[model samples]
Target chain A: MSITQISVFVESRPGHLTRTLEAFAEAGIQVRGFCAGDTGEYGIVRFIVDRPDAAMALLAERGAAARTSEVLCARLDDRPGALARAMVACAQAGINIVYCYSLAATCIALSVKDIASAEAALADADIDLVDQAELARVLAGATL
Target chain B: MGTPMPAPDQIDFSALPIYLPEVECTSRERIRAIQLAKLIEQVGYTYARVPWYRDQMDALGVTPADIRTLDDVRKLPFTDKSALRETFPFGMFAVPMDEIVEMHASSGTTGKPIVVGYTAADMDVWSECIARLAQMAGVTAADRVQMAFGYGMFTGGFGLHYGIQRIGGMMIPAGAGNTERHIQMIEDYGTTTLIATPSYAMHICEVGEKLGFDWASSTLERGLFGGEPCPPRLKAEIEARMHITCTDNYGLTEVMGPGVSGECLAHRDQQHIAEDHFLWEVVDPATGEPVAEGEMGELVLTPLDKRGIPVLRYRTHDLTRVTTEPCACGRTLARMQKVRSRCDDMLIIRGTNVFPSQVEDVIGRIDELTPHYRIVVDNEGGLDRMTVEVEIKPEAFSDSFEEMSAFAREVAGKLRNVLLVTPVVRLVEPGGIERTLGKAKHVDDRRR
Candidate 1:
């Protein structure tokens, strides 16, 4: 019920972001979604890529500090309050949302405190969650 | 599965005849004669080949013939790091480029690095010298030596590389970084000896703690540590943590990587200089005059048999004293005290030498970073951790977390590139770091 998310520690500089993107581009890795947070000196560049392992290998080959973690993605109808409902379901289940981001209007990726509880909560709420296979298909440019 | 590790006291190094017993155990008079002859030949070769040496000798009004006795070495002008820097890429090379089969360099205060070359013969001498030091430190053919020093332009890696090979030990050339991999190798390969900077060795211990990898339980018996000084307290702490005795080594890139001197396993107090190949002197840093024996002073060395870039009376800037008293190990080679400090602003972190000015230069290149920065060095579980706290330009201050983190990583990466060491780069608000009047304090060393 989750996809592998690779997070790289990138120094916050002018060319760092550019170089990282260029590295991904050169490796021909497609990024489905990404969210970044900066703490002045460095930034965490997180990516949801088609080939997470390949993307990580490319970053490692480039000597970029990176790591992979599991993040949950839910497929919702293209409408407002869809994320709010999913988040409310997780909040009701006592699953805290660490961070959340969305690429298309219908797909929302969220990192939660408890993966199993969040998945159970989403399942009980009749919300369709994308597994690794569905996420891979989406990352491969397939319509959800 | 692996051989039993030996206790520090149980490691019998004295019983093993010293490497190169003929040279190491030679009489003081005979050693002096060898030094005098090699000094004469090397000085003449330097003056004839290296234009910088010839010009310096001419300016000092001293010729190669002036070096008749070992005392006459004082007549020649002392070569400092500045002299080496001024020569740049290849000016100080006594041998032609073709003859120099290998080259290594260390970071200078500025952008230009101090380049050192080694001929095939020089490489042999380097290996032999390192092998002698290694053997003195109690490494043997049965031991599997894991070298953690980075293998590249830096001399520390290759110095240990050839030396371990000369000793006929199984070498796992595990270059620097990836502490996890190093620990895995130790567990998988049954590594007996570890060669790394004392700081790096400490860092590996920290990694072991995080992964719950018991280094004390590992097959690592002894460590040959150099590239920086290891104090008694630190040495003891490392020995306690890893259950191994660490012998501190001393060397310079200009002289010949890490073969200059090392401590015998029998005595962990002082490093024995390879007197047969290099002549050492402890002198006043200011006056460049020789200090009394056993007195703390700057180290000066002249390569007696070095051919590629023969360094004559080269001031090492490393502050230490030389003692000629016989060691219990039975080697007659003179022992130099452990180096605690330098005569300059250079700082050694995890075996990589770094200068504040070099770091400042890198910071200055970034538009978002202000020139104000403070380097704080701390010893966390015997590992040296450097944190560079710098203020960001007010105009560049961003509320977005992405911008801030991206900037920090960039600075850290650039620093890792130039310094060959990764420092925790912390960005503060403008004017966060204090300003000083006279000589701005760039480094706050809290390791002690």
Candidate 2:
């Protein structure tokens, strides 16, 4: 069974995300990674957390609106055109990549039509496929 | 076993029956009269049990005896959502805790879920009223039913589910989403009735087409679309796709779920309320007086038969035009036109009240954009900042971001003239905005 990295949405308003993160803080659920962008009023703070269930409960108890879905944790080389090659391959594979945003400083998040095909193509091109276990380790305070 | 069958006269339905007929033997005017009488009974019942209600009624010099007829409704106090927030959770339940059977709540998208209860009798009344609704929508005992409403703390799924079973129909509790799965049951199990939100049913039709399933030509004959208003075009769209006569329904979770009012296929303009179980009042938004017949105003509701806890003169915040005229379908119960707009969803942008539905009406008329859009509200200095972000068709893109922004500004300019609200228009790419597994909420109200 493959565990999926979930982007728990946290609001950016005052005390909006405090209790949510506090739940994880108390549960000792370390965040592996996160990316947040704001439209002045609201922010979509997506995160890769180590404790998915605990994190869900923490946010849920606080009534924070969040969704846990099976998102692929794809890894690519931090080099020029590395992202392009993957996008081109996916496009060639008839997979439409809708809304590509940043997951981290190095990694980019793409909501592809076929995550499995995107991963397969990236692997075929010799890119490192970051599994959930690896992401958990990285998010669990492990050095890159 | 057949030889020992008793006569129909031996049947005992004084207890809870699968379907307790609402308002066939009892006339609607009689029901309203009974409702006024019940309102008095409820006030007295609450005065002894519910202190806040007693205090409020007492403060108005309005005792239970003061309420006698429907005209006396003005003497009774009005209740709003703010009062619910003040007394939330269980401040309103009339019966003691052990008597309550179930608890359902409002979405509380803004705040905490305002909880309401169902007594054993409440459970009975809700089902029987909805059973009458299903009968009106053409669902008979032989039909296999598929309900695609979201069930949880919310009430739509459970409300319709109980109604289907009450009408002696075979029920597949296909609680919303998983489109291909619902289609499989519709095909293999031969389900005929579909009860769900209009948008969700349309989504199902889209998926069935993509997956090569035949729900359109299948045995499905009746559809009950509710939770939100469906425009005439979308109503026609769903009907064509499902090959079923799509009927519109109206209700609020606060008003005890989905069977408040429903449109029969004969006409979509007016929906008859279950006046026997619930009382309907259309009050002018400003004056709070009853609107004359065929006039526009806000809808106020009072549950007549409810016992666990009930609201009296509860303002629904839904704006509509009402009429008591006889419909093509022979029911004399008062009917209301589908809501014009939610007063709360009205945006006061640049001195004009811009309703999302008005913008949606325009967008639905235009073929340029997708059905999804967001009104991102922020604080513009001391003023309210309004951003109408619309998704451009994937095939339609400007040469530059500035060009796209200019196009959006032109659209915004048109909207400003139409709605009298100047909005900062931002043209976004297709499919970046959020989508809910449930209700499609477009208004992002900032400043809490």
Candidate 3:
């Protein structure tokens, strides 16, 4: 199962992230989990939001360059080596995890090249996978 | 007799009067005869006055008598910038200091500046040559010409100034920079013609836009651009934005500056050379052999009647094609294509030759990319790597990393198709690259 993630292109400068968050705040879009990476000249900010479609529409209205992509969310054991086990399962199944980040205490989000194979491999490894609806439900209940 | 004539603004530029019709509109045979006689005279004149010329000719065992036909011009020794540097200031002057009336030198960013002295007669010839070029580009005596080219040691400003004076036009003499003042003068004086590099003209348009100055509303109608290569795309942008017809002229300080060849309004693609004053030849940069007809090669020029500082077969290092076919503008002089790049600007990346102009042409063709770019070459692990940093149009930015990555790949693919070597294309933010008022620097080689 996969959930939609929003990636925003921003120039690498002061107040850019703050401005992006302000735009989301003004639009009443709740960002569940977010991470940013830089490439000297510009940065890419990826967000797991409550309403991705609305956020994307808002970003478009603001003339911001952004895109939505599917990412797999996995509910892991609240213990050490939880991510390692999931990574090992994907690696053994020859699934490429493009990027991964922690969403909550025992919930992690991963962007993989082969989402179907990655979801199947994680399910086979006895790990629970979260879809879009389940991820919204968890984010609603969790204090963030 | 019943049909109405077009307004002055709507008149066809091709119908404009040739400044020196006797020479510019002459027969090719007569042009060749004039070139042969001038070449013979120039060779002997240089041999007698300048020791550098005599020594170079003696070493090759070639005498002035050897140059009988125009084809024999190949036998003369080629004078390059290094030769001028060896002679330094005033050493290459064929005339005495009292005869020299004016002097100009290149910016010489690399080392010592190469000086050029113009006698009173030489100044008159320079003015006439520029006037002929100005007329070819549709500059009329009634138009108010504003010069944005700097008027100092650089030849651009003074060359155009003298030419505009000769044409009896109202000269604004605005000089370079102070963009706001230039804009004000253009509006207040109703300037109809602008003398500037294409890049500066583009910059002025941008600044004008920022200041709420409407370029289309302004009286600017013609642009005489030189000092750097103006690609057709950039020229079109300036013309559309400023509502002006942009013309490109070619020149170098080593030869007579800004008077070698210029584009007429009728045939905007090629520039008509002042063949009466200078003999032009296109030869392969490597072997110095003539290229096939209408093929690109290094431009070699020999100033025929220059008395103060005479040069024979001076290698311009600029690469362009030349065609002797008569122009539609009624000029029988040879026409050379706009010089897009120089031989010295060629970069050997990973054993493959690449020119910045090629990269520029590729970038200009893509809709989402801007012409502003920098070619950075660095050696890593004893292997050369070229990175083309291109600015993306603000409207073309995509928030998706995948889409942007694909766009970069597409640009790189196009570049590889042209250059035969793949380069890492980095999409930069709009206005990320620096702009210049003078010649734009395109290469950044860190391998050295």
Candidate 4:
């Protein structure tokens, strides 16, 4: 019902974002979805990667500041307003969306305050939630 | 190359070894002789005028006549910021209000602000001291100096303003803040020298880079950074970013602003103290006993030339060591090392002493982290917990769970290595820490 999202704290400097992505690439960790929220001096880079632990170790080795949080991944039709429909369900369920981004094709990742409630709301609305194992498979370039 | 040699004394270069060559370049023996004379007169005058000093001297069973030699200065009682606070606004003034030409005060963030007054004669000495410091930093009458320190009640702005005016330097009272405008002014006015706190100078560089301003090629040749103790890392960073010769200066409102001591261009490691104007001593803060020469301790100062508020053994609360060794700048005045930290800002966490500046040093060195951070000390259960909330560079952000945790652990380890206490390091967004235009707030203690 929920997918684990890794969020890394990045300073607002040239090549910081590149350094972070390179850390994952060097470790051969494939990221399925990504969203970055910037506040001038720093940005929060959130990722749904195939090998999170390995990616984290590589980033740690390079001395990058990062963290992790949970978000829900829902299967949606590759059509217009699919994201808006999933978001409307979340809003109706009273689950606030911190941020959301597209995951591969026909999948959408939504960060929320309460993952369980968001999952319950989406289930009630007949929206299927992708689990972490499924996310790993999808991020590995497998068609979901 | 074929020009005839000119007489040594005939050249009269505008740049001199000392602003007041007769006093600053005088023999050490003569300097002390002058200090002793000024000390005796100041002691007697304070004892006669200020009731607090008279009571303190009376309690110590020491009279003005007992202060016969420079060593006799130990006989006088120590005056700390608390004494100045107790007296409040005008009680510390030795001379009457009519004689006070200018007044300044500390921030007083905790409680009452410590106020200080200066007479016209005292202002003359202040200007001369600042001029000497300016000349040391390569500022001359021909240059334009932009003062970034705040004006009004705070002393830094007015102190340097008058000092630069005294040296005949074109003064730009830019005050503080408005980074874009400050840079524009520098471009428009050709500001050759800048007077600001070290942190503010670093911030200016950040803004300059963001605005696509070429700060490296700016007219800023010298930076007189003071108001807060500047770490060597910060100084290096400022110099590298701004391409300016940055020198540190020290002063307090309790004493006089900005003119207490400053670094000469030849030697930026230690600051030259204006010994003739103010009698300085290094004493153990705990015992109030004078420490040996070259030993680190709290600074005790007594204004010898100040008439508005002649203080007796006023504790500066700043920690540093003094060396009488002659500087490469050719000035005979004693130089004090850059201030390490303030005793007041020192935090004791679970019996271990920690300075926020130390944490700042560590953060400054880490390229991934910005120097802006907050030290949060809170009481957790039965023990005290220290958490350092530092900003991560926006470019370093990655959504990797393992990466973020590892980064936090590494930062915590680095901090524990220096502080000897394990602190929970919280890495927030790049702009998470609050930025202030004035002195940066490094600590937020909630244990109290």
Best by lDDT: 3
What is the TM-score of chain A, computed separately for every candidate? 0.92, 0.72, 0.94, 0.89
DockQ of 3: 0.21
- Weakest 10 consecutive residues of candidate 1 chain A by summed lDDT: A135-144
True contacts kept of 1: 0.08
Worst 10 residues of 2 chain A by lDDT: A1-10
DockQ for every model, please: 0.05, 0.02, 0.21, 0.15
Clashing pairs in 2: A32-A139
* Cα lDDT of model 2 by residue, B274-338, tens digit: 77667778776666888777655678888776777777778999977677665545555667788
CA lDDT, candidate 1, residue A93: 87
lDDT of 1 by residue, B347-369 (tens): 76887656676677688788887
Q: What is the lDDT of residue A89 in candidate 3?
A: 97
The DockQ-based CAPRI class assigned to model 1 is incorrect
Best by TM-score: 3
Q: Which candidate is the best by DockQ?
A: 3
Predicted candidate 3 versus true structure: per-residue lDDT over A13-116, tens digit per residue? 88877877998898888888878887765778899888899988987776565678899999998788988999999999998877888785478889987889
- TM-score-wise, the better of 1 and 3 is 3
lDDT of each: 0.81, 0.70, 0.85, 0.80
